[model samples]
Target chain A: MPAPAIQVDNLSKLYHIGASEQYHTFREAIIEVASAPLRRLRNFGRASSSDSNIIWALKDATFAVQPGEVVGVIGRNGSGKSTLLKILSRITEPTEGRAHMRGRVGSLLEVGTGFHPELTGRENIYLSGAILGMKRTEINRKFDEIVDFSGVKKFIDTPVKRYSSGMKVRLGFAVAAHLDPEILLIDEVLAVGDAEFQNKCLGKMDDVAKSGRTVLFVSHNMGAITDLCPRALLLTRGSLQADGSTPDVVSEYLSVATPDGYVDLRHWKSERSGDGPMRIEAVEILDSKGARAGQIQAGEPIRFRLSVRGKSGAKCNLSVAIRDMMERIIYNPNTSDDKATVTLPAERAIVEVSLQENRLARGDYSASVWLGDAMNVTNDRVHHCLKFRIEDSSLGQTRSKGLVRTNGQWSVQRRGL
Target chain B: MNPQSNQFTSAMTADESAPAAPSEDIPELIIEAQKGWIPIHFGDLWRYRELLYFLTWRDVKIRYKQTVFGFLWAFIQPFLKMIVFSVIFGGLAQMDSEGFPYPIFVFAGLLPWQFFSESLSRSSNSVVGSSSLVTKVYFPRLVIPLGAVGGCLVDFAISFLVLVGLMAWYGIAPRVGILMVGPLVVLTVIASLGAGTLISALNVAYRDFRYVVPFMVQIWMFLTPVIYSVDIIPEDWQWLLMLNPMAGIVDGYRSAILGKPFDWSNIAISAAVALVLFFVGAVVFRRIERRFADII
Candidate 1:
């Protein structure tokens, strides 16, 4: 058990905000300052004090990163992702708890972050370098590398105010990339620069990671997160909701997501059994030998065992869906696939629904089981469905990720001439 | 001096020899990440002090950047106010300047007072103006206010040079008491830094503090003994007057530059008030600094 590269222990931050409550006259402000202690005592004497309003920006956040690991932090607005980064960078302190870091953290928090508008690009390079805890000699040694990397050789001496936002970002990132901080903490600011710059930064980050530096990256781009980081920490409203392999956590997050943090559990309840109308108890996604497995190779026969009890004598049909991590229905198998509906008797029974998984390729999949009775009608009154994860290795490489692996092939040729 | 240059993590080029993935590259910024008083390398601050000095210089340079009168404006400000007071308060109303000529007398007081006003106003707003830096980058917050105070020295020097010319014209040599002006000027710096820190903290939350600042400076001028001698205030009200720290500061300047002995009781009051202000201001500023990144 080696020491984690980044160790955060019960970290929290509090911010006191003044409401639009009272408008103090200048004299009142001075008088209040004069009597601060007395007013504080008076406020404390009350059951609750409005003046001491606190916003718990980050709460009991604890996690760590192993050396050279690239971790992504994902969340919506005001989820405390940025606040946590600021604390780790030592730009601010936590109200409680301690965060320990083992390396230098280079952050691209914002463009033109430390550049002086009046100073030339060259001057700002030195200034920003100093701000990142680098010395002049270190900057001098890497100056050429930075200039070349940023592609701002021509305007290196020009005052930064004259530079466009794109140029500012290019130079800013060049300096930061060349900063050689052992642990890189990058926010979404990279998305600000041009697409080319963004790609260049991605490549630079790849190189930084290859060179064995730790990186804690935050972005809303799920595609980018899956591609860049091997592991991820998902934040939701100032708490660590999940921390695990990229694919598993992302799938869980997607399933439980809402438009505005208002979670719609329609999909979540579908996969949960044992407390529904039919009294679905346990579900096992099995292989050919009735062996339970979390995954299988694409184009293989997958089995689903769902146990349920029928309280009334109603003919029931079984339906199960195979969806990817995003909950998109990749394949839905019905018990009527044999051209004959299998009717359920009025009693508690164990049932099995097996389907050929040949069409699916190598990727992660989920099983959604539903029990319903609607033999005479096209649609059925379905009960609850259970969720289970299944892996298919037939798509392509075992390492392939995302919605699923598609074995689609393409060929390019010139027109006959 | 990138202190970190020599502190890079141990490299395990061969995979078989590597410890793990993430911790392998963590930088050694903290003396001991897990424990003890993490000593701030003041030497590191010193190495980068040039940027600090330049920022201060930049603030001073930008102040007069688009203005027409340039450095002369620094001189004209206290000079004009000195003439106005010399006419209205000193000549017509016949106020005492310790028997010294009114222009020189008032100019001396105006000099320190102007420094305090300009320094305090700029320092209080320094944090808000540099919010981008505070939120986006990491540096000591104390540096911002210090730079503003440091920037005023340039203007102070320029303005002080004109005071020497005024003295030569009046043929009034600075007395032995002039030596005391050094400590008085220092008290002004400390006092201004104190007030600046406190007001800057408030400025972060209220934002109305920015608008209130100029008005505060105006009212503060009337409260200080810049226009009149402290001797004229009734003894009963003088105790209340001593509460304004700048009161004793300006009077000390008059006593210093005019060859009068120091006012012991008044100096003690000013010292007590200025120290208290600095202590309270530093604590308030430290308390507010935690949320600056979020709120700013």
Candidate 2:
């Protein structure tokens, strides 16, 4: 057999938590170096104590992917999925072990990573492409195709700052998608742009996978993962928990957690990205009678009480999405969808949302919250932060198959035979 | 069925016949923890030569994007400095110019001096300024500072025109010794890049190191013979002055243009120091570069 395209053996990375917080100054460094000998003498013969500031972001992760294999990396926040990708892409050095990659490797850790605001779209294409490791000749060959895919041909000569945020994201993804490497590593860059553009990107990725190149995809969207990747790896708290077929690994991930009726968002252990002027401090799942419940009956009405914290007179667009165990988003409810406006008071306030019917089948489900403006800026977001279960309806005990349950009236009339 | 699939199939068939050839064509990349005293990887830098060009282009393009004067500012900066120095040092102090006019002499010296100073300051802050690139992408860290220095070459070329205009005004044509100016300018770049790379690496770890740069450049100008001629110094102490790499470069430019006798000993000493500084700076930069993404 041909050699594996990527081989990772016992890779690990340790990060210092509080040590990074301290300000590093030349004066302090000089003093520390000057006093090193005295300090060593003072602590002579004493065993080195474990420093509390250190945490292993990744530990003993060993995996290999054969050529033409597509693998999905799925994990909750701070679970080492990104850390693993970063190490493989050589953005950060691993603390121990080694990784061998055969053939050309291109990583899209972030889109628009080196895009300059002052540069025109055409110039940024070349600049960002070069930064992403594409040669000039390769970029020249694919220039027209990249621009056509992005749909920003009209503004190709305009500065990037003039483009809308969605336009920028599309252009960024366009350049990255054109990278024809033997091995591709992608992070969650698909979680941008409108739904239609996201579909376009996913289609392009599907084409890339079909071309028989090795790929490692990391995303919080389980539906995308199940659709694109045949095999998957699951990480939990910096450790590889499971590696198997996509369905098995996803099921293993979903089964690892118990449903929660309430979650404290303030101290939630997740990687959140946003410029937060407003935040979702906490969330509570409530039944029809206003009591906390971890499991609700299908077809029953459900309510959510969100504790929001922000400055007074701050306007926010709040959206909550509910997904089933397969992590396919069933439905989303947004305040802006109803043309309703929300203004937060100083400190903290509770905003409640009520749904007429859960309309969900018997299965485990999760709810993710998002706080942002009417524009594309996400002030705060927590993915799959709250989880609950939808039990069978009281009338019947049959197991359900699909994601949603809809009630329909049936009518029949006798006709001439 | 489509062209894309047809290409894929053909490539797969070819690969099946020559499995070992592909590996031989593209070397495998092995990533592990870096050990002590990492040497500079000139091969990796060479492989990423295109990125260096693009980065340098970006810097030069964005520098004068909205400015009304554009490249004229490059000439204006050194010209203004030359006028002020000629008045103060040449007129007020009556310092000797070794036979050439003071404006021409100082202008010649300022041309290389400004290049060195500008390149040094820009490169010293380059890594910190491109924090986004450093943290998000992987390339040779040396390229950032090198690109910054390269961008200044355009400004230096533009400023060289002003020196020619000044020499024309004084009716002092350059002699055959002017050919040596090319090597002298290269020596100046080496010295600037050496100090710049060292400081830029340190600036990533200690942010306050940025403040030290302008102050250091100000003091460094005095130590070098930019505004004054080195002939005024006693012959014995001239060797001590040659320790500053720019002293020899500035002296070399004046002698090259003014047709004075060459100082081989001083130039040789300066070249030696410049090479040593480059070596030390690159060694230190490579050692600390592995932690840049984490800390930055």
Candidate 3:
């Protein structure tokens, strides 16, 4: 199998939780080292050990990939996905084990890693190419292709500061796509950019894979992963759980992810947007029978209840956003859409939204809650606040090719004939 | 097309062995936990030399962009500093200029000192300022600080022309001694790079260095003999004062441009000290480079 394109063995990384936070000056760092013995003596009688501060970001990860294989790495947040990519890109050293790869390696851990805002688009192309390990001659040869691919030919000489964010991302992707390395390591850089550009990138990646190169794709978007990769690896809590066919691995992941088809967000403790005047206390999904349901069948009715609190007499425009497994916003039902603003009392209130017929395909989906005011300002919002699954229905429904399914009538009139 | 599609489908099910990658005798790279003190990888640096150039170009372009003066800002900075120092130290304090006009003498001193100080401060902060680039990609981390120093060299070159004009205004003709300016410029860059690399590496670990640098620069300027000549210092104390590497570089510039006698003893001591500092900085920088992405 051509010596396996890449081989990783017993790879691990260690991180100190709070220790890495207290940044010290050069003098303080020196002083700490000098007083290490004293500090150790002072803490000799402590009951609980201080080892809780240490975490294994990655622990004894072992894997291998054949040449020309496209493998997807999937994991939740803090599952060591980023750490693994960083190690493979050599951005940081591994604390244990090793990774070996054949041929020239190019990693796109971030798009436009070295693009300067002040430099002209043309100059940034060359600069970013060089930063990605492209030689001058190679860039010269592919310069026109890159400019054409970016579709920024008219403004190629203008500084990037004036370019739209989409234009910049397009130009950045163009340069990275033309790297032509033997092994490409890409993180979730495709999560940005417009849909058309993302499709173009996926097409390019398909071409790259067909050209006899290897790819290691890491993303939380299962649709993109399944579309591009034939094999998949699942990582959970810094350990490899499954490495098999894409569908099997992905199903295993989803089944483990939303075990009961729902995640309660009564005490979501992460950072969210908006002021303190409004807050989302809880989110619940109910079935047609008015009972809490984890999974709803396709085309079935579902209800979303957002328990919100605000000052008395304050008005809010409550909304719900539903995203498919690919993390793409498929549906956003907002009170503002209908210009129907609701008034909330000083205490707590429940905002209910009912979906008459859910058209989501058979997959895992996430729902978010948003509370905004009349001024179009988001007063409170929480993302990925609820996870639920849509089970397959036996109504002989025609499968759709998109995130949502819809029924449309089509008839051909023979008037012309 | 139908037959081809059928063959493709059949092949997909028929083959059990993975397809071989296109092989071209490419060597494999093994990445592991690095240990011990490895020397600088000159080969790797050579491979990434283009990135260094591009980074330098980026810094130079970004510095003058959206500015009214553009490159003129380079000249104005040192010229204004020269004028201010000439007024305060020369006119008010009555500092000695060692037989040359105070303006030209102070201008000559400011040329090298400005380059050194600018390069040092820029280099020291380069790593921290580019935390995104450092954390995102893998190249020689030293390129950041080195590129910062390189970008400041353009400013030095621009200001050097103003010094020549000021010397001409004073009717100080060029001499063979001016040839020495080339080596002295190199010495200044090396010294700045040394200190800059050390501080930039430290800055990643301790952000306090960012606040400390400007204050240190102010104090360092008073000690570098930019406004006054080193001859004003007592003879015995001169040796101690020359311990500051920039003292020797400023002295060299004044003597070389003003046609004064070069202080060989003081220049020798400063050159030795600057070389030592450069090596020490490089060592410390290399030692801490691995931890930069993690800590920062």
TM-score of chain A of each: 0.59, 0.71, 0.75
lDDT of 1 by residue, A20-62 (tens): 3233345566776889888788878576665345567778888
Tens digits of lDDT, candidate 3, B4-75:
753563354234113323334676889899886657788888989998888888888889888999999998
TM-score: model 3 vs. ground truth: 0.83
> Quick one: ranking by TM-score, best first?
3, 2, 1
* Predictions' DockQ, in order: 0.18, 0.55, 0.50
Model 2, A287-359: lDDT tens digits are 8888887788888899988999888787778888998644578978889896666877666888889898678
**Top DockQ hit:** 2
What is the per-residue lDDT of model 3 for residues A1-417, given as tens digits with 9 covering 90 to 100?
A: 369878999999997766544576677778879998888888888854557656788989999999889999987656788899899988999999999998788999887778888888999999999999998887887787788778899999999999999999999999998886678899998887989999888877776777678999999888889999999988876888889999999888776754543454556543355655777887888878887776888888889888878787888898888887667788888888867788886578888888997888877887878888767688787776667888777676546766688878989877874
Q: Cα deviation in Å at residue A162, candidate 3?
A: 1.5
- Enumerate residue pairs that collide in model 2: none
- Which portions of model 2 show Cα errors greater than 4 Å? A19-23, A35-50, A259-386, A389-417, B1-24
Which candidate, 2 or 3, has the higher DockQ? 2
